[model samples]
Target: MRKLFSIIGLFVSCLLAAQEEEWRVIPSVREWLEEINNWPDSVYRQDNLHVFFDYEKDTGLIATTFEETDSLPSEPLFIVNKPVRVSGLNFAGDRKGPGTMPRRLTSIQFNGWLTISRMAQNRAGFVGCVFKDDMSMWDIQSRNVLQFVDCDFEKSLHLYGPQENMGFYIANTSIKEDLIITSGNTDAGIRILNSDLSQFFVNGKFTQFRMDSTNVRYGMRLSNVTISNSFQLQNTSLPALELIGTDFPELHTYIPFHNIENALALDLPIGWDRDQDLVKYKAESKEEIMDTQRFDNLIASYYTLLEVYKSRGELTSYNACYIEMRDKVTARSKLLYNQDPSFTNFFAYQINRFTRAFSDYGTRPEKAIIVFFQVVLAFSIFYFFFPSSWNTTNNRTMMRRLSYLGSYFTSKEGLSDLFEKEAKEDYKDYEEFHQFISSSEKRLPIYFQWLSKPLYRVSVSRFNLSRRLLASGDILKGEWDQLPKAKQVRTSILIGLYLVIYLIYVLIIRCLNAITLSLNAFSTLGFGEIPTRGLARYVTIIQGFVGWFLLSIFLVSLIGQILN
Candidate 1:
């Protein structure tokens, strides 16, 4: 008898443990109320209908609210001590009879497979809940706050047509699939904090919207969203953001470049019919008429973003937005050209394209310089191959002309023939003195030989023959011809060496002259006479015109940067 009693006690204990592991389903509102009412006063508070579940017991409760028949007890709080799965919990605040007090559900821990439908005229808050299936809330209308905290939704969460709420707050939540909110209007604001979401879409009108420390793995789209107050985003990672017909009074974002994977789509057509097959219709068709308002809105949006980034000192984002804006403008101009087919429209489109390629719409001045050098180098190579296209005047003549121009501008003496003659005489005397010092070594006294030796060395170093030979082809050829014939055969090897060096020197000089000519044409400096003839002269004129245009743009950009 003692052994049987012990066995019975053990069996009872094991059955209780099995029951604790399974969910206790409250079949109706009557049963749910009775179970909570019988709870000890220490665990249940009457004023707020707050019930604290026993944590030590590890009870898993399942509650059901039938929208068609049973109604939830008024203003009930359901707090779970352990993981609980609540199914078919429906709140129909709108369906309540007149003078019926609205139900307020607070501190509800929905552990699994929750679906809320027709929730209205009441407040609801959920915390630390893990939803196992797709959860959706439709037609939610609450005067008090609707809040979700520390929740994880394993599947998609959708909220539809939530209207006139005090505020909607979601924090520290994770959604595995898309979290979509559509047509939501709020009085206070909507705040999402420290949430990890997949695809997120919000199309609503709100007093304000704030998101912080949230990461969206997929793309986010805000279509037709209007915010009367500020929209703030801080420390949010948005891989792809699309803004279509979205308007806000102010945008405050502290997102880094890496957080934004794609460029913001500010230029998306606003007024076009999104439901139609736009790709099938030709742009020139009447149905595809450009909306001027849409274009202006896009420009205004870009300008606003640019100002915000500039104020925040985000130069990379500012430059990116500026480039995108310019491209949009160019696209608009192209559309106008397609519609009108007029010279003005065509020219505008072409010029925008040219500027975009040449300097990235003037945001990068270095791009302009790079393109300028590329043009100069290309022309230089062309001129190098076709020597006859350009004139190779005497190097001495070019130098003399340059010297004359410099003297004309800087000389204390006026630009007169007497001034020129004095300059020539001075030059001639200096040349003669240099020759005497360099060649005539016996003219110096023994006492002054030290000074003479230094001066001679200086003169020889200053007037190196190799440099003169490189500077002028005529000088090199003359020196070679001046060699004595009988001695030339004796020094035939030396002659061959000189010829080889001269050929190399000529090639280098020719290349440098080609580059110089290209530079002169590109700068349009006209420091001396034009060195091209025939078609090349026309090409140089074209190059000069292009140079003037690009240089003007570069100067404007530089000045703007400095002023800013």
Candidate 2:
């Protein structure tokens, strides 16, 4: 009984196989020529004598042989009026007999819908074809070039597993849906020009891959692809591009973006905080850990793009890519820190953050300068309000004397001979000669008097106050101190004016010294003595260290820029 069942099953399988092969029977070149000749005038014309095949009625297959036929047109053209599906189309050169050479089809044109599950190939060219349905060509092996021109694919087009030495050329075509090519080794490479595509993807190894003057609307991804010679994109606009484990030997010089209108979108594979989330999810659900290979590939892609931009001298794009790369590195470090909580990972994460914040990973030296100035300005403001004892001069005695004179004037016994004697002693060394010498040494040129006159006058008047006060010796004598109230008041007013001027001068000098201190600490120049004491000394030391680090980074970045 079992033997009988087996025989019946074998018979059924053979019948099914035969039935499937019956529809795929393709007409010979001679038969196709006869069909073309028999078509009516309305269906065929002399100028375009291509054969039209209806999918519902006509067998949509054309098989070529090893024998050269004289009747075949130089450029054969076929039109499919409706959607057609074929299990396999053997357009490849087929051997007819021993020692017979394989025949080649140079060019062919298809006008309408056509679908093929598998294709065996020689040289095949497609022109002006419009595929209305999804087309899948699996494991295509072509001896020569496969070309497509001025074609439109309304649905997805999949080309899979092309063999060695097969060249694919596509120009002036539009693919409205996804176009996917996967797992091929083509030494002659693939060239796509002046085309618009949606969701294009390629995963293969090739000698070269180039896309010029093309626009990809949705997204394009190249995963596990290796191009040994070159990979180039010229005047191409890829709105979203994801590259995963792709190797391009000539990435530095070949990817040009001179004419692209939109900014290239480098879509990263994983989020910055993806690892943190993964950690949490694993703790709760105990699912498999996420592989960090994607992150590694993401970093490599960023580096490749960075080199491309740098080689092209696109500074803005280069810096942007550099910053992005550093950000990814920092994030990866953070993930490692989260995983192990080690000091090394923590330090690395923090260091990356610092570099990104200060210099954009050392790609922009100007950023370091800007941050340096910000630090100096901040410290300057702090030192301005709370000046250290070393940078500030002790003016308490001068202030006290000013206070004493004001009080003496307010008191009924206005002033005393003792006070007058002390004042004389203090002003005795003041010289008119020294005043002129100092003013001359510090004076601005006469031509700049228009801009500096006000400041110059203020300085000169402040310096000469001592000489003017002692111009008459009687001003500070005993009789003068015992003068009437009106006279005493006049003398007090003159002294008050001098006190105000001197105080203003001292404050101005103090402000300048504070700025000097700040600059010295921030730049670590140390041109002169650092007189800071106590806490201010420590603060200055810290600023010096920071300055050293930041300046070193600035120099490195600047040198890199120059070298680049």
Candidate 3:
């Protein structure tokens, strides 16, 4: 780009050299404007304007080349109607000398705007200068381009009427305002390259609106940049607005415009942007940082950025903006109470942001996954600590024993009589068996009866073992009075069955299966086919209830997103 400019400079130098030289110098800015009003086909240099401002008597003053006073005026207002070049001047305030504090500049106050009316064959430009209020080329009566480069404006500018044939070029300038061009029923091609604009509003109709390599403070607000003709925007940034190209939606202003970023760019005092005037910002250096609203202004600008991301369908960037806003809000909220955010904002409005993060403020449905895992872990711990009563099989055995005792108590006879009758039957059976055995042994072979004794013992022992396997109570091989009863054993019914085969550490029965069980429980899908007896079954039931509630919250968040 510099090379292109250099080539253009060479051509202009050659063309001027070919023509007759009418080169001249002016004593003051008043004389310069006078020269422009008279002759429109002359060339001027930026050094002449600097030389005029260096005259200390009129250090911070201005004129329209109409007044001839060398005294204080209401404000600085200048008219450029011919070819002019100027740079580095402040028509107001006590500013430092040249390069005293570089990059810091004093401003020229335009109480309202700059007036321009140029003829053909002449163009005007101001570089590295300051204009406070606005710049308007609304009265150019000839074919000439008015360019502003490396300059600063406290407010916006405007151009209309015959702007196409003599288009304007604004490069490397900073505007602390929105640029508005009334291009309706015109063929002007407005080109703004490599500059920062707070905003842009192209009203009416136009043939072309082109902006490139520029950073727009806030995004643009326009239904369209042109009226059935041309509008183009590329390589530009709407840092605050996030509008790209010409895709500006029809915007409605709930509040008026504030070039907050430009204020920050100039490092002006807090609330300096409230008024669209060029004024040097000043405050005591010892002021508390909390009292300054530059941080708050930054947050407001970031919110504008957030809206831009939202409209652009950039969720990642949107989330970034939200995080920054959250932090900034925390900082600003602390200023409301005290400077110590850690101590003062414990229960303030800023704390709401934490709650929002935990639940994602109903914006993220996926956080339910975290809740699901949390609940599963919680219930697993509960079940681990509290053993279930239903798993004990001893209760069933105790109930059976109680029922037997009840039946015996309800008998017609007393306990002694019952025992006597059973004993007499047993004695009669023994005597009959003895007599029969004696007869049979005498009648049959003695060797056969002797050989069957071991077999009879084996059969009796096997029968006792079989009864123990099927019975819910202890097995007795002999009469109850003849032997001491074995102690009953306590055991888990269904739980013991699966555990002995499938579980070792007692948690989830199998390590890998824990995740499956947790997920199923969280989803409220209790597929009972998996033998979940005793404490495991109890935990599953509890998980079902909790899972239902968690899922309901997740669904609510999802439906909100869809509706929104």
Candidate 4:
């Protein structure tokens, strides 16, 4: 069964990778403009195209150049006619859905290059239009010299350039492939983004570029561009890149912009990135570390004592009575009282039962036995899977990598040291350092915490083991009387098995806690609660259980075969 799942997982991953399309390649500025001039506007889907370009008519559209004068206010010379249809694609400038009519729409094909220059006003120039939908793949590649001049995209948009260098301005246009800008003249450049006006996107590649300041919400690149005299400026919004041709070693001064507000090409300090407009993340530091530790310890200790009492049959009557009362009452809370209160939250009361039971189970040998069996099952599985910690850690690392950072500690001792230091540092510095470390480490705070968790958990296991051994009359007799070798060997094996099972159970419970916390953390990252917690979390838990179960079976089978 586990092998079947492994195969299915691999197949699905392969399918997704195969389905993703490659981004288009944009053309140089000069080539792009000329291609636009040759565009078959004659292929207009409606009369709207002519209305925007016909100078003879006093229509709100139609302008000679990129200048907003008394006759022409908007720049970037050419504007696409609304409600244009291309290659079986429908584009409407006016987003009309019942009462909601959008401002305007622009359309471009990604098959050639486009270029724009000599504006009527605004020395920088501009070329853009409100788009109801994304620009198609054919509009992005037909130009070489493309410039925003001075334009803003309104709505969620996409750029699809040509498969090859066709040369054309793909502004207010979507490129199918890479967003390449090969321009010699200094001017405002292309800003391909969503019509919603939230971000700037260069789906594939970025080659040979210059900029004063830009907020590429996702990321940016500049390949084969000379940057000594032409400085690339970056605002505090997005990441910037200086792409030196792979062949030119000297040009590969790939210095990431340290200043969030300034990506100007220059030597800056290491701490400059700290000043950027990153969402002020202030993690509420816990002031009472020992107190928190004591609380957890006390709860765990109480649960362990209860387990011992149950094992000895001392609490059998009390347990029975409590169970009876619980079944009669709120199903778990036989003893519930509130100071100066008459009523309690029914839902909270129910939840508390499971929470307490879960807590109690976590501290018992039964939990370890369950977890050990699970690990054995996982080891039995026919297909390969990562270690349990791998999934959570990998997810965290990926997010951190996207944010451009690395981890400071990847080990239990290292993590413990980090927390100790963090607990003592200034609040602001600690938070920044935490974010930075998480980003750098490519792991979440939860994962780092897990790495150190085993150290503390081992203490519980060891203490319990000692107590269990001391309580067992026969085990103590074996040790004291120097009993037969076979008996001692059997006893040792039992003890080892006991230890394994208990460890597995504890680990699984810890994993569950991590699931809950990580879900809450993801909400802060703008992901929907449904995606982060519902289906995804359940799937993860199921996978973990199945993998562990299969591995255990496999290991047991292998051992049996060897013994036979």
**What's the true lDDT of residue 307 in model 2?**
69
The digit string of per-residue lDDT tens for model 1 on 260-344 reads 5344543322223334432221122333336666556556656756666776777777777788778777877888899899999
- Using all chains and alpha carbons, the TM-scores for the candidates as numbered come to 0.55, 0.58, 0.38, 0.24
Superposed model 4: Cα runs more than 4 Å off: 1-53, 58-60, 68-83, 88-128, 137-141, 147-152, 163-197, 203-206, 216-233, 239-256, 260-564
Give the number of colliding residue pairs in candidate 2. 0
Cα deviation at 452, candidate 3, in Å, is 32
Reference-based lDDT, each prediction: 0.60, 0.61, 0.49, 0.34
- lDDT of model 1, residue 342: 99
- Residue lDDT tens for model 3, 1-564: 999999999999999875533323344555545555565455433321222333444433332221223233344345444444332222222234432211111223333355443222234345445666666655343244556666778776666555335556688889887676655455555678999877665554444556777886545544334424344456664433321122323221111123222222113221235355533221212233354565444455565555655655656555545654565455456565565546556567545454355446556667766766787777656544443432332345446534543433344433334333434555565557556666787677878778655555565455445544534332332233333333112222332353354334343433335555666777887574643566677677778887887687778767865654
Best by TM-score: 2
Quote model 1's TM-score: 0.55
Error of 2 at 26 (Å): 11
Q: Give the deviation of candidate 4 from the true structure as CA RMSD.
A: 35.3
Task: Return the TM-score for candidate 3, rounded to 2 decimals.
Answer: 0.38
For residues 1-564, could you state the per-residue lDDT of candidate 2 as single tens digits?
999999999999999988656533333543443444455542322221122232222222222231323243433355434344444555422233222223333223333344454455555555555566666666565556666666677766777777557777888889877777776545657789999986677888877788888887666777788888777888876655666677777443465443332222344232123223211111111122224554555556677676667766777766666665666567667677888888898889888888888888888888898998888887777676656665444467566767666555555423443345455544443445345545775575765545555655665565456445454432434344567888878876776687788878777767777777888898888746557666777788888898898888889889987876
Report how far residue 364 has shifted in candidate 3, in Å. Answer: 5.0
Q: Considering summed lDDT, which 10 consecutive residues are worst modelled in model 1?
A: 60-69
- Best candidate according to lDDT: 2
Task: lDDT for model 3, please.
Answer: 0.49
Task: Write model 4 residue lDDT over 96-201, tens digit each, in one string.
Answer: 2221111121122222222212211111112443333333333332223333322343333333433333222333333222233343422223433321122222
